[model samples]
Target: MNLKFIEKILIVMFLLTFGIIWYDFYTFSQPQLNMNPDLSYSRLLEYIKMGWVKQVDLYRNNRLAIIEASSPDLGDRSQLFRVNIPIAASQLIQKLKEYDINFDAHPIPQKNIFIKIAYNLLIPFIFITSLIYFFQSSNNIPGFPNLPGGPGAFFMNLGKSPAKLTESTDDTSFDDVKGIEEVKEEVEEIVSFLVDQDKYTLVGATIPKGVLLVGPPGTGKTLLAKAIANEAKVPFYNAAGGEFIELFVGIGASRMRDLFVQANKNSPCIVFIDEIDAIARKRGGGYGSTNDEREQTLNQLLSELDGFKENSGVILVGATNRVDILDSALLRPGRFDRIIDVPLPTRLGRSEILKLYAKKLSLDETVSLLDIADKTAGFSGAELANLLNESAILSARYKSEKITKKEINEAFERVIGGIAGLAMESGKIKTLIAYHEIGHALIGSILKNHDNVEKITLIPRGEAKGLTWFKSRGDARLFTRAQLTSRIITLYGGRAAETIIFGKPEVTTGASNDIERVTEIAYKMVTVYGMSSLGPRAFIKLNKTRQFPYPPKPMMSVKTRIKVSREVHRLLKGYEKIANRIIFENRIIIDLLVEKLLEIETLESSDFYNLLNQYIILPSK
Candidate 1:
């Protein structure tokens, strides 16, 4: 029986026993009386003295008397009267004898020994039973295996692994996974090994025990694991790294052990732990230093990985975006033999992903997936899926039959910037927003190393009053100093335009985000990229485990820190001056662009560049 069910039964039985005992005691103490008028002791004495009493029956050891008497009120008929007799009723008995009244004294009935014992012991028995239940609930008592606090408590299952076992099926195969051709190729060998272990073992080559999938969030790390399991055609136990952690001591380790035990029992299976960094973080002082439970769980996981035999047939696949913070023991050769990086999709990859998702949507003939892919350079596979989903939503919202290029473009803007908000009315704020965005487009277009302007609009989107997008020039891996400096100057353009048009005192906080980006770029150039006059040296050591909003303190001396700050400031000032000079020189074109932008509320790259071409020559790379 379930322990909780048994506990309920005991409670009901105790209540029933107590009720029965109390009912018996109440009946024994007060027997049912006859239907007679109650008389006072004085009235009874008067009746006896007047010779009106006929007979009497005493009960409860002379404490109650039933008297049969005749009086004028009774019309000479004998009537029974009940009276509560006093302790000293000898005189009443003598009077009854003198009156020749027939009296009989009934003895008190004896109670059952068991009922007496039960009535007296009910409270103590309840107290003792409660103590037993309390001790058993905490699992402190022996010989009570089926009680709470014992081994049978409901919470005892907390130590069990919460991994969901997925039977091998062709529901999700590699064909469904798009935009990661290289990553698919990397794991194809593991699938082959799981299919026919003898193929590799015949040549005396051992299979890798584990594979680590590292990538940014939403880059299809978990999807890749599913694909591998489906291709292998084996039982897949999927669990999150956080599932093994518990508030109770040793529970995390127990869960970790249970997970692997089940994996080993079902040999030739795959165990995929997503977000492994949650438990496999680097040991010792840092973020998880105070969490001994997580440390012990990680230790247990390492032991299980090490215990795997060359032919155990249990392949472990772990995924995390923070591989840098994982313990060295967990990532060692035998533990996580192969480390696969699933990076953001490239241009061609994005196009493939878009096409795969576009198959489900009712797209217009002019809707081009390639064009949308080109605009989304750094989008991951999941993000690409969302873009099409958003486009379809917009199509439905507008009651359109099919998704057109216009819907896709709007969805792209929505995804990149945020949801479009109400457009600002024409006034000082609108003019200032128009000038700010135009300044960014103007500076970006004139820069020799910066990306080309894609679009500029005064329509508010997300938190900004206006927006300007720059077209990415493919997936450029390395950036030059000229390119970095161009980006910084472009970021400064908004603030410079605000200062020039409205004066420094009237400049709005619209450029706050721009100022932050400018500072980050300038600081990176001086402290990280070694592109400043302070010599080619990195002053700030990168701490992968360091969380944001609380970065690790700089290790440099006061003089070095002062120099780094001055260099960053100098970089920002120089870029600001350059942005001001360019904007001031092209004030005529700026004014023209702002007027056209306010009227149409939007300007494409071609239209923007065409207007600029009539004034100044566009810069060459």
Candidate 2:
């Protein structure tokens, strides 16, 4: 297991091997194995005649044996001693006994001395090691054909669930996870059925066959499934959908069958398949023509789910962020009957997740969680938890005793885009970012569908060097033409800022995403929404008819395509010019905010609003 231990075994084998080899050659003339061959043949005969055969077996064969007790030696080889084979054999044996060799010895399978030495020494050792390995392997994990639990075989157990026999997932308890309360409630109800199926059955209520947890990543889909198992107090059968596959054929199907069989044996149990999309994705999406293996796997899963007895008490719970891409059969009623939607965590939910994850992390006593919460509006539960963990690690790396508000802020920034690297500037870069952000807020502040603008930051989040965030108006519904016009202007704010302050060629490519978004919006309005001078029409849709998933447009000539491209360019230019004018009017205030941004990378909407209060009357508190 340890390097030193392996070294010890190797060292023992090496020393024993060397010692045997050295003794064989160095002491071949020694009295014990080889007696005096130099002695007269007649003298050795006298000793041999008086002695009895101590071990007759080896000598009884054709092999010549030398008596070990004689004080004699094999001596050195000499070409001058032209000995006759049979004539010298009796003479040599008599001489060997005189060398004081006590025991008889054979020539040791003279076929290959090196080979014979190796064979004799290594065979027993190899046998012993193999024996130990087998016994250890056999005794290691009863019933399961697993490797020994010792460190040598540790990796053989990879991919097996580490979930212990606790009857539940207590480590992933509901309290530690927050937000998506609706999903939590839904999961808890499933757990209730598992724990008290008889109660529901007595009232003539049948438990749902399956529950599908649908959500974006980090919305606690997997965690919710664990909470169900924890609440039910039943053995949870956990396996990822991808875990079903193997290099060998039918293993995926076999694994699935085994998993279902285990769940049914447990009776009231939960089978949580994480990332079900791995196996449940539309089978024909890949393999060009078809994949019989994948199709078979899907068919096997379907049969086990739908054709099985309802009261078998094995409820399937599957989690996938890409539920829309899943097979339609999986979504049918009685199969994942209740599709529980786990939405991206709200701000309040992020706070609870932050506190829970940060509960044990060292923090400066002055860290304001509510402030952190307000700043992290759109973060998911996993993202928030990771933010705290990464901050604490960063604090430790920096040798800071406690995580600072600065660290938390920096961590949030890191999660969004990346760590603000050496992109720090000296002169007027921050000023440009500030005015750029303000242009966005200025346009958005007047819009109704867009909630009041929340924060503007030159401090980069994700790829954007600057971003203007607008709070959502309730559910954040679709936009109309007027709302979309403001949206396009807001997107073009950076270019407008550059144009207003630096003018013309000074406008950088920092607004690539903004420009792209603006282009997309303008194009969608024309081709899809038909808000442009272009008549009501739709362009792109994914369905097989490929006919817009609604209605196909009447054939358009080459002339119409060029005219539409011109209209799109005109719309983008019109928004850019209008946004530039708005920023130009407020040039002095833009200069002041940009200076502030250079000093501190972020500015909340309230602060920007206060600065603009005298010039523009923002809609009332």
Candidate 3:
């Protein structure tokens, strides 16, 4: 039976037991009265002497009598009256015979003694016994602690550690991890130290007490920790940062202490805490300050890391995406001695990830992992795995034994854009959308710094009525001013095309997202990148707040702010003019492309470029 079902049954049994006890007491104490008043024995006798008594009934061992009589006081109507008889039963019988009244004697009904005992004693005893048994059974359930008195006693287990302990296993190791070769090298050293501690200790070297893994989400931080535990062949204690915190005061601190106690007992173990920033956020009082429980938990954690007692042989590994919000004490030299960064995969790294995931799937002969990797420039390890899984699902849906390139292509498009919507009917709206998308592709082909156009489609996907894809190299870590300017012009191409093809007033709101991106790039150029006439100084200061030890504010004169605004406007206008000129020069090709796009509704990069080359010379990169 489910535990919840057992709990409900026990509660219902308890309520039913109490209900029976109450019902018995009420039925015995309150006798039934049929809307009649009590009469004295003398009054009853007078009624009988006056010949007003009609009938009588004896009840409760003949100690009570119900009489039906007519009297002037009762409005000359037959009425029933209850009266206590002090005389003996034989005497009452004699009196009733003398008056010649019709009478019937009723014997008191006896109840089952077993039922009485069950309602009064057995039921209550069973309820109490079941309650105790339920509490005892709860002790065996995970997460509930066994108290000294009983399982259902006070919440003494609130302080108990909820961390899960896993014995050493060879299921996962560094060999199973891919796409992070540099991070793996750093972590392998730690595993080597754990496997042979004397090698480091003899040379007067101490293993880091804690290793903090900082990176964006889905970048293989947690996977690295698992590999460490498996490679080192030591006990692993896993817990989330949230498990140490609770709403009750002192519970968080108590759990923190208990966690360290267990870690101490299992020395030479790896304690991995995921999302450590939850409990170790910077401590301060402000509008969004954490509660006292969380702060207390953090303090206890600090004490355990580098307190009077030496925490040797216990290596702590923590992973977090938000390292900026962690407390300084938690990140200091003695606590977190090593901080490793796990970044997104590069082009070569992505290829390795794709190959690793592809081993599990059956692909067609023509399908290539390298081509897929090139298309997925910014995808993480988890996303790459998901893309292949989606392709496999599509193959199954189509009743194919092996995944084909067509399925992979469709899955890739679905993952990047949303699911494809219905095909649009050919009309003025479709023509306008075609022109808008063509505008973007034309500008991208003409720009020297922009990436090459990959695909263009008139089929609606997600919130976009039309879409254009760019094939990025994904290896560039830095961009020059010219590259940034070229991106802005490419973004403005759609609006520029719409304004020239249809009148300015006929342009639609399809470019809202594009305009937002253009504005962000232009503002960042002036404020953050210092790429405009505003000079080579960042005008924005980050991490400013009213919390303790606040950062210094950025000082800028009102006139300088105005100049910054003007510079951003100048950058936008200059790029927009360039985009318009390019679109105007390619008007004939644009019309021909629009007609072809309306007929087919889709075009690949090779086909698009083949047609464009027939009309004009393409720009050389």
Top lDDT model: 1
lDDT of 2 by residue, 1-621 (tens): 344454467567667767766766555422243233432335435545654222211232323333333223323221111111244364444444564334444343332576476768675775565444533442354322433454434334432332222367367777855877766777777877887878898988878888888877887887887777777777777767776654555656666766676667777888888888777877676663225555666777888888668566788888887775688988898787788888877667766777787778888988988777776666788878888988898898889999997788667667766766454475566666676777777766644434577767776555677777776544333677977897898778778887777877877888888898999889777776788776787543334311233243434567877877887998988988877877787777777767666677777767877777666765642
In model 1, the clashing pairs are 136-148, 136-149, 137-148, 137-149, 138-149, 139-149
Q: What's the candidate order when arranged by decreasing lDDT?
A: 1, 3, 2
Give the C-alpha miss distance for residue 441 in model 2, angstroms.
4.6
Rate residue 368 of model 3 by lDDT: 86
**Candidate maximizing TM-score:** 3
lDDT of 3 by residue, 71-149 (tens): 9977999988998888553577888998799999877655568557867776767767676655555444344322332
In model 1, what lDDT does residue 345 have? 88
Worst 10 residues of 2 by lDDT: 76-85
lDDT of candidate 3 at residue 548, scale 0 to 100: 21
- Per-residue alpha-carbon lDDT of candidate 1 for residues 1-621, written as tens digits (9 for 90 to 100): 354765885697688786877778787876575657789999988898888988899888788988888899889898888999988776777777777889999888787886777767765676666655654555532322322355434365667776888887658888877888999899988898899899999999889999999888988988888888888888898888887777776888998899899999998889999999888987884544237888999999999988999978999999998877889988889989999988888888998888888888899999888888889988988888999999999999999999998999999999999988888888998999899999999999999999999999987788888999999888886889999999989998998888898899988999899899888878878877899999889777665422232354676899999999999999889999999998999899999999999999999989998999999898774
In model 3, which regions exceed 4 Å deviation?
Answer: 1-19, 34-131, 138-156, 285-290, 308-311, 542-559
